[model samples]
Target chain A: MSSLIVASIYQQVINDVIHNIQRDFEDSGVDVSVLNELQQLWETKIIQSRVTNFPPEDDKNQLEQEEDMENSSKRGTNKQKAKARSKSYNQNLSVGNINQDESEDELSDANSVVSNKYPENETKFTGQSAASLASIINTSNTNNMSANTGYPLSPSQRKNNAFEEDYDDQNSSTDDESQNQPLSTRAPQFLASGVNAPLASMSPMMGQRNLDQAQQNSSKINDLLNNNATGNDYMYQSLGSNSLANNNSQDTKKPYLPQNDGCDDPISVWKIFLAERKLKQLNSANKLDSTEQNKDFNMTISQVDGDNSENGGDITEHMVLCQYDKVSRTKNKWKCVLKDGIMLVNGRNYLFHKANGDFEW
Target chain B: MSQYYELYRTSTLGFALTDSLDELIQAGHITPQLAIRVLMQYDKSIAEALTNHVKARATIKGSLKTYRFCDDVWTFIISNPNFKFENEVVSADKVKIVACNARRPDEA
Candidate 1:
């Protein structure tokens, strides 16, 4: 019986660990199967402990106590705030119940780390901020849909339908002669509400470049357009769409954080890879005199002469990002191998020491 | 407890290292001090550790170390499939060290 309990506890731990790993490595190239290997190791440890007539110690009770303590404090404050908000919005107890169910799901998903509403506030993790944690924690599917979807959702969906009417109202308010008119059909209303604009229709690469450039040029306009587009009503009412709506509401939440880990913005890595290739070509061809080619690469190259006095002094500048290539010959290759690489996080550069083959900062 | 040595350090577990160490300690696999020592010696950077602990950055006495040798005194061992790392614990009071050997499996 003790072994069974132990197994269940270990399984829960493993499941929680895998979920966290999935959340952290969502869009990265990091092989998450390493966690599986670690899981197997734990299983072996459990088996070894069992065979030796010594079961793995159970800390489930203790963990539960710590979690309960953590939850009560957070729950108290959240209840007060939730009560005040519901009263001001003239919302009923159903909304409060739905929000409670969502936060509980978030707590379990984050391994009882206790995620609060205000993401920018200081998080409960050691000393990190809530935004830093929220960026990585997947909080979209935490709603207990089965319990609250049928009854409590009608009011919210009505609100959303009302919101759609507003979009229609605005569309009709526009110049009557304009070709961009709101379609009478409900499904087409979503597509016509400026949600699927010309920019979204462009190829992903062009769209991304245009979006980046647009953001750099006029961030306010970009944000306004995004807000206007996503605020429209949805035609479908599936769980997936509901979660997507939640994600849209949390605009500040990024799918990933800019940690020193090599899995940064894939676009940034691609840009660096292209820039490095161009730099290598220029270096090999003795074309350092011209700054024109550098402009073609679209990367800033700052060259500092090592020493003026030394005849054979080599020019030295730190590579903005270093990704290790197992095949040394391929180190100059354009593809990024970020598995073992130098990552700069929070201003401290965690470098892959070429000499020791270990990450050092 | 003294006879069994830790084959893996806390840092080797990657991003989940901290939580894994805590679990291992709670499970009685290893003491908390051992985990702390492993973390302390993993990279040994005051600034990086502090920044990792807190989201804020600070300047410390020793920054990250870098090697840009002009001479051939130190040869850069390129990452090869044969680069095998063996971590072993010899005796109690002695530390577990990682020894890397660059040899292919088919090599005589």
Candidate 2:
């Protein structure tokens, strides 16, 4: 029976380990399957433990006791807060239970880690802000639906969603594993700190050329109306095809990249990729200059990271929304990668990068 | 105790990585350091006597696809027909992560 108990013990450990690995690698590409065989061993142990009713360890209660002791100091008003957080967390976990294997209690404990009601005021992995982590972690099914979100979701909807997620991330339960290093944050927020670093100093007019081209070629409204009357359907179709083909070619250039190890470290790999991208941007800009085209507004470095504030460092009291040079200004769409290679998106700027806004419109 | 190594030793039993375990650990069901340590040791990057940890970006989901490179961080696509990845620094986030399939038949 001791062998059975040992089997159960190892299985439990492996199962839990794989579960965490999945969470780490879920949305990102850190293929954690390198450790998957261990999961079967764990599942077996769990089944054995259940059939035999073997109790391997009770250390969980000891930790809970310590947690209670820690929270005892603020027992007066935090009871409600704790209850609400734990309750919602439990609900989320129960929902997860429909798809997972953990016991209800175990899953609830885990959900609290990503729920809006934990004590994640102290972050682990990397000491990023609650607001950022809230968006990054526990967002498994976020894009399961198409981003073309049937009806436009208002900015308030986005903010409210972001706010709830931030709450969960900030107050997430502080597990031992989470207490390690902080998550990766791309490039130290190269622009947010207002460092004036060259890596973050590309001009924003970099993107305007394409917009200007689109607008310039957008045949006058009267001409378009006349063309609509005279032109054949084939012409419009061919134009549409040409536009899509151009965009596809730009997207498919397959810029050079260093082989990346895992899926979860977008920030790290992106920074490394961007380092090479800087040279390409310079080359492209030079070519444009030679042709005497797009010289007016054609440089922009808009990096983003955990350190970024609303806009570099110069926030205006009377708000002037810095408009982005969009590939297409159609609403509810976000295309950071444009026909002119990758470009900036409005919302957040990193380090001290600013958009040198020059519009031909 | 050394989960990855033990599996490596067998090298016979079919192995498929599960995403549920990653969720559990992120949610605090298990320890990340210890778990990753055990996983890495199985990757043969660790010595039995060495208990210390070495960090590297493991797997990532990017805008286009969800993929994980080998230990050297070499490129390997995890789609329908698993193939060696060409060199490039690809981001890991902003992609939809699907569950990994079974390991190659010749891995043993």
Candidate 3:
């Protein structure tokens, strides 16, 4: 007996990442071709994750995603692309910059090009080079992103998990009584059958401490001290093209974990979503506190207006915060996304929305 | 009041297109049905006049309607890209971030 499986990343994404690698290694066309091919091979693994419906280990996906985005966003525009892409941009600047070493062609000139533009002492995050898209699709994780309650995953996490093809038969055929029952009555939805309720009316928000949010606040402070970026780095990777190799010899052991049994647990999903929300609140308060410490940082983080790169400007958006309302599109479900964020008039940063997802100009 | 307008006059950032000559004439920036191209080519003084109006402010209240654009290009300024109406602090006392992307009826 024998079996087979294959994974994929969009050909466009591979092409996009490889294209940047090509530019970075322009002087060494052979190595550029080799690395481009390597990135393509890696992308096949990503497509596999999507098929398996499990996330990849976070860090690798994050890095590939970041690099892929930086390359893509600056693409098409010839003169207006990032100056920092050239080896010369970082040549004069800070020490121990990881991007410097990867930029191999001009290592000798690096000694003289120290830059004061990017403040020294910046702390940076590194993620795994992702081979699969599913690994990077978690509701809260992004390479350049700080958890924003503002913009949301369009086909959100719950929807992705709940609608997996395998679960359709089992879930759709629930007894009529259960189908018609109001959502609140069931306390054990996503909980696997035989898993008992922890407690009714239990305050899920009360017990756990959000250590990650606290840490993110401190890291942001570290980022300001080290570099000028106050969180304008948020982006999604662009799609590129490449050819993947044979996966017949690849290892495909799945990490042991609970599968979605779907007995029905709204609290679990809601709590997971709110984990980032709580983090956002903490980060906002902490940002306010830090703004008192440094106005420059606040301005840097929140200055998201009127700079269209199409206008031949070098400015990057520092931040453009949005908050979408909860809108019901399906049974007892709402899409929480940022385009839903109502905008304010009078050039004011305010919006008024109701519980029913209505908005007034 | 004149001084306030001076402070907030029609700088490059405050440039916008008006849909009607009636509105422009009503605001006294132009006469009825006059060609916009003629008005645009001739209105270097409007900014100067508006600046004089802006400098008269005692407090930052009652804003006049004007189009603030990223550039002088019409499409770049008016294309409804999402904007965050971030309120910056002149003094560090009142700073906040909010989503703001609407034009008042007059400006629209």
Scored by DockQ, the top model is 1
**How high is the lDDT of residue B88 in model 3?**
22
What CAPRI class is candidate 2?
incorrect
Q: Per-residue alpha-carbon lDDT of model 1 for A56-139, expressed as tens digits? A: 323332433343364445433333342333244333222212222222222222221112222221111101111122123313
lDDT of 3 by residue, B1-108 (tens): 121111111111111111111111111111111222222322323322222221211111111111222322211111122222223211112222122222222344
- Candidate ranking (TM-score, best to worst): 2, 1, 3
Q: Which of 1 and 2 is ahead in TM-score?
A: 2
User: Comparing to the true complex, what docking class would candidate 3 get?
Assistant: incorrect
Candidate 2 local lDDT, A1-361, one digit each (tens): 2222322233333444445456544333222322232342233223322222224223322322343365433321222333343344343321211122212222222233223322221121111112233234314311111110000101111111222233333344422222342331212111112222231223232222222222321432211111111111111222233322122112212221222234343222222222333333344334333422221112112112211211221111111111122222134222221110011112110110111211111
Ranking by lDDT: 1, 2, 3
Worst 10 residues of 2 chain B by lDDT: B9-18
True contacts kept of each: 0.02, 0.00, 0.04
Score candidate 1 by TM-score against the native: 0.19
Indicate whether candidate 2 or candidate 3 has the larger DockQ.
3
List candidate 2 stretches off by more than 4 Å: A3-52, A55-59, A63-361, B1-17, B20-108
Deviation (Å) of A86 in candidate 1? 31
